[model samples]
Target: MPDLLGRKFTANEPNRVYVGDMYLPACDRGGKNMYLATVIDAYSRKLAGYALADHMRVSLVIDALAHAHGVRGSLDGAIFHSDRGSVYTSQAFRNYCSSLGVRQPMGAVGTSADNALAESFNAL
Candidate 1:
């Protein structure tokens, strides 16, 4: 549980970071593969924030995080939790998080249960 607690504390930092992954359907306005957005608070059981896009590229993840931060504020030591999706694993997003002082922690690969917070949020 220490890891979870650490994530929370990291998120609570004055300008901490928050992270999550999103999945979009395989269809755009023109019927392309679209993914849904997924994000969560590392500390407050609150959903914190999220955004949607037609694509599941790293840009979508970055945009969602930007929306969350815009809603909440600065993110310094925020702990971002996510599955090992390529978008989340992308160098760009990881670099962005590092630049913002957010610790990027990937959920165990192939273990959706490990990210129950995100699963539960989606259900909500």
Candidate 2:
């Protein structure tokens, strides 16, 4: 299992932000258009990674996590936080988090403040 993520910012630009974007192609699944979402890191502002797929399933999130983990090893039980979405709640993501030994944390339902970090980064 991987460790947690560190809160320390080593780069000079500690306030910098990184952005990632997901674009789902046209596909028919459950009679709904697929969706995409990105997760970015603040500080060392860079497009760390992204994920795009036919559906906004939990697997996509796990794929993103794999990409991130591949680039940066071991989160050291760091806080893996996200909005309270169904995909985030899916077993795949949960299992992936468990395997990585990362703590899964979520914001309150319908509360923007909980995901302020992600939203703030997106706004930037």
Candidate 3:
């Protein structure tokens, strides 16, 4: 997969680009785990949108993207970067991105540095 971000996390304009990732709690109590999907602006380092759910399904990611789209008001030609997670690679998510004119960019598999910003955000 090509890196649409070009390993550049900074952008001149907002809403034109973003990076996203999913974060799960360190421990799961009672066999229950909560997932947080977040989209952040590359230029401002501001959180565009986020969603929390008990599952890490595709819908969780979709909802996060939807929320980002909603908050941004428009995402046409926006570049969304993420890791090679199944939810981000699912056909449904691809279709959703296509329908919204958002470009999905994936970094190298198993390379956390490719998506450092999102990982950094998750660390916080």
Candidate 4:
């Protein structure tokens, strides 16, 4: 994967580009943390899809993207930009993206600015 997004986070229309990422929320009274994966449409800056799980595995991200596909009805030529995390870079995730005809672009290593949209969302 390459940084195809080139740090540009805007899109001309919905599903043209999507920025997504996974985060771990604050632990609850049970001291258990939940992982959340989110997809935001760049054009509208709205939440297109999301998935929460007990673990931040590849399936978490996959399910998030799948939700986007279901909602939008198609994701054949969308760009999915995210940080270079293992869940995003895993072979399984890559294959899932390919299956949906979604291109995966990664942010630079250790560079949070490269994925500002999804990062800012997680901060909310």
Clashes of 3: 0
Show how many residue pairs clash in every candidate, following the order shown. Answer: 19, 10, 0, 0
Candidate 2 achieves a global lDDT of 0.58
* Candidate 3 lDDT, 44-110, residue by residue in tens: 9999999888899999999999999888888889989999999999999999998899999999999
Q: Give a tens-digit lDDT track for model 4, residues 2-112.
A: 888787899887889999989987755356778889999999999999998888789999999999999998899899999999999999999999999999999999999
Write candidate 1's Cα lDDT for 6-82 as tens digits: 22323443334444658654456776666677667645656666767776678888877877778877777677777
lDDT tens readout by residue for model 2, 1-124: 1212232222344212222334455556778776556656545544455666667677787777677767666655545666677877778778877897766766667765656656555554
lDDT score at residue 9, model 4, on the 0-100 scale: 91
Q: Compare candidates 2 and 4 on TM-score and give the better one.
A: 4
Best by TM-score: 4
The segments of candidate 4 whose C-alpha lies over 4 angstroms from its true place after superposition are: 27-30
Sort all candidates by TM-score, best to worst. 4, 3, 1, 2
After superposition, candidate 2 runs with Cα above 4 Å error: 1-34, 43-45
**Where's the lowest-lDDT run of ten residues in candidate 2?**
1-10
Each model's Cα RMSD: 3.9, 6.2, 1.6, 1.2
Residue-level lDDT for 116 in candidate 3: 95
